[model samples]
Target chain A: MHRVRLGIVGCGIAARELHFPALVQLTDKFEITAVTSRRRERAEDFASMVKDALGYEPAVFDSYEELLESGSVDAVDLTLPIELNVPFIFKAVEKGVHVICEKPISTDIENGKKVVELSTNTDKVIYIAENYRHDFRFNKIRAFIDENTIGRPIFVAWHLWIGMDKSNKYVQTEWRQRPKHIGGFLSDGGVHHIAALRVIFGDIAWVSGVTKRVSDYLGDDDTLSTVFEFNSGVVGNYTVSYAVSGKQYFEIVGTDGRIYLDEERITVRGQREETINIPNQNTFKNEFEDFYRVVKHGEPNILGHPVDALKDLSFFEAAIKSKDTRIEIEDLLRSTTPD
Target chain B: MHRVRLGIVGCGIAARELHFPALVQLTDKFEITAVTSRRRERAEDFASMVKDALGYEPAVFDSYEELLESGSVDAVDLTLPIELNVPFIFKAVEKGVHVICEKPISTDIENGKKVVELSTNTDKVIYIAENYRHDFRFNKIRAFIDENTIGRPIFVAWHLWIGMDKSNKYVQTEWRQRPKHIGGFLSDGGVHHIAALRVIFGDIAWVSGVTKRVSDYLGDDDTLSTVFEFNSGVVGNYTVSYAVSGKQYFEIVGTDGRIYLDEERITVRGQREETINIPNQNTFKNEFEDFYRVVKHGEPNILGHPVDALKDLSFFEAAIKSKDTRIEIEDLLRSTTPD
Candidate 1:
């Protein structure tokens, strides 16, 4: 098997903690040939760690432009800050390299479309690395619904309440604390939920939402309560808070039964109650595997499609900006279409 | 203790099953003086049941107007269909008798405002019996919120999914099966949830909502997903479906802790986790006790206030009619004012 040459574009926490750990396991599929970051020392540390694990020295570049110019890689794993996502995607694609960028292709719709247009006009694989689409738990939930184990789905209730305290590693990140994204952590991290919803229920047609800025530590709105109406005529409630005590679950109640997805189990309640124990699976690993297949084998990409990520961001943006009005998701997308 | 003379003006399911069972226990507070209904046989059956329990032979009247004219009761408990609620309140008040009418005050704003005006003008106690406001479980929840066990209030998520099967007695009822009320069962039964929300979170300021008509058995929209913004700037999500499998819960997540209220217990997660086992209390009995206090002792009526029920109905109506726009609760109330 020909190993795809990979470049680690960011030496931030996610790159070091999430990506590198997952990449080291897929040695046959990917070879880390280069690393780059704003901080050269972090990039050197990342390359040294990669070299020690895979027994191959990698080139370290001070800038993403330099990494692209060096020609040391076939594809770049872009995990930079939110504001830098689209700009770097354009640079990588312009340099004729396969690009797998992190979630939220950009902070807003205009830049997100630029990636869509760029990917449309190029053969270089431009995949948006949204892990939730690749997350196994949500996949099980989607299968359960499709199997009619719970009958036809009538409604859904998703509750996410996490206290993003200073002790939490994600909360300690400076950009998250004062986000340049549309709704701070609400958009920066909320896209995953939208992706999962779309994965299970298809596209949302409309959203009526309310938001609150609860914690000063978390910039923009930290809490959102929304009602989503899908094209299939199913309506659901989503309440997410970053300033509260923790409890998380996604429930889909249907005509014959209900399916509940939590961290530990998938509970099916109907004529015969059943519990499906969720095995521990690294979602980032799953995402990387799919990206590898899409790049190497020319496989059809669903999770990595830039349009899917764009739809997720568009839904997130519409929800937070709804301001107590029912926003049509298609209308928001339509307005963003280049004239 | 002087027992207040009470007339039962409806002998349908609620009057027969809920009121008689509850009133029999409050013999020291109320006396069964008369009974009336659209069906005379049901009224006779109810009177016999009352006499069997209380050792008092109550008059069986064929019409509510005759019961009002009999002058044998100081107050009447109105548990008729939703359409008859406001009209009968007017009849009882015109006869110079006090009333404990069933929720909601009326089906829409115009008639609802009439009750508000009449209750405001009347010297006699005209109490609207919205049992959820008097339910002991909700009282405990309110006390929990007021005690600040959950720290500063942040957000809430309320999920109610019940499969209204043909075997269910309420679903079998002709009125409920084909409700004359707006939004069908979504309004008739959904009022209780609104009452509980108001009791716990105070008056809601605005609502953005979506509705879905899922079941053919359910007359109108049987599923509603709504985002409520309270006057205090706290936001919440409420999704209710009468067409799906049963799973009910109201969760409030705050800074210091969280409160989970389900059928069995109030689970509090905080510094020191606690579980408050909810004792089964007949809410009808509690509501009758409050009404007795208001009529006999001339005490201030909180739960039994007609305007409170009106507000609950107004909020329900606004949410169902919101369509795709955000409805201001106070603006809805202000529009119903007697000009």
Candidate 2:
């Protein structure tokens, strides 16, 4: 098996905390050849962190195009700010380099559409790094619904509420605190949960929401409570808050029973209460490895396809739209389980 | 304090199961004088049931007019079908007797406005039997919020999903199966949770919803997912279904913490998750005793005010209207705490 030489774009926070550790676990499948960031020292620091974590030093590029022209990379791992993805993705595809970009390909639908369209037109494969879809606990619950463990799913509730203070790391990032993208916290963090819903329940058909700015530091909607109708014909309710302290929880109700996911512990209440199995999974590694398989052996894309990622992005885009328009977003029967 | 002699109307299912037992518990504050039903046998059965539950027999009336005109009652507890309340309430008030009718006063805003108007015109007091307002667990949570145990109440979510099978007792009733109310199951059961929100938060300023009939036997909207914006400046979301099996649960999320209410337990997630006290008090008895105090000592109504009940019903009416019109119901900033 040939190892795809990977160039890491955007050596920012996630590149250090998440992707580098995940890449170290897949030494057999991928070779980290180069890294890029506008801040050359952070780019060098990312290389040092990678070498410290795993005994290897990758080339560091101060500019994204320099890595593309260096021809030392066969694929690109994009972890840039959301709105910064389209041009890099377009350039990667034009260079015949396979690309794996972060969730929410773009913050807005127009830019997301361009990336999806251009990536589809090219032969180079593109994948979305939506780790929740790859997370084991979520997929296990999805299997329960799919296998009729809990009868047909009818309702879903997902709440993610956490306070943002000066001490918090994301609050220190300028792009997150006041993003050029429409929904700041909502787009950056909310995309994962919405992607989980899209992965589990098919696709969102329509949405209506009540979104507000509960935080002073956040420039856009920091709190959003939305009701969604899945294309599978189930109603799912979700509330995402970056200004409150109700950690996180997701519950799914079906005809036969209910699956309550309080953080990692899952309680399935059917004829009786049962604790379902929770497998140890590194979702970032799982996401990267799945992308590796698609690039290596051409394994059919399961939940990692960029089109599948676009569905959630579009739904979230619609959530912001619904908040702005003060109306339920209808006529949004986007393709489900993209082939 | 003088004990109010109370006439009980409508010897239906709830009359036998709920109110009679509650009346037994409040023997000192309320003296049962007469029981009425359209059917004489049911009325007699109710009197016998009350006698069995307590240690005395009350007079039986075949008609509401007989209960009102018999002069055997100073106040009446009307537990008739929801739409049956307005005329009976007017008759009770015309007789200069205090009346406490079952929520919502009426299913529609038009009939509800008439009841609220006529009750205000006369001097005799009118109360709506919104027992959930008197419910101990709900009130405990409310007090927690009011005392700043939880910070500012910013969001609320309530979900009730239960299948209505033929074996169910409520399914045996014709009114619930083919309800004349615009929101059938929503008005019948959803009003309770709605009232809980309206009481804890202030008056609802606006609402939007997606309602559907998930049950074939039920005539109106058996499923409803609604978002309410309170004039108190909070966003509340609710989803109720009579077609799935996730019993009933509601969570109130504040700026600092959250309080979760399942069927029998109350969990407050603040500084720590202590299953807050679930004091066992009969909501019906508390409702009746509150009305008794309001009537005898001229005490201020806590949750007994008809206008308060009217506010919940109107928000619900707007929910149904929002469903039918395919729009958000706005400009509904009715009175918060009624005079």
- Highest-scoring model, lDDT: 1
TM-score of chain A of each: 0.93, 0.92
**Number of the top DockQ candidate:** 1
Specify the CAPRI tier of model 2. Answer: incorrect
lDDT tens digits, residues A178-231, model 2?
Answer: 687757888788878887787678767777677788878766778988776886
Give candidate 1's error at residue A35 in angstroms. 2.4
TM-score for each candidate, following the candidate numbering:
0.91, 0.86
Candidate 1 retains true contacts at a fraction of 0.37
Give the true-contact fraction for every prediction, in order: 0.37, 0.13
Clashing pairs in 1: none
Give stretches of model 2 more than 4 Å off: A47-59, A271-277, A296-302, A324-339, B1-6, B22-35, B47-62, B65-74, B94-97, B161-165, B212-221, B243-248, B262-276, B296-302, B324-339
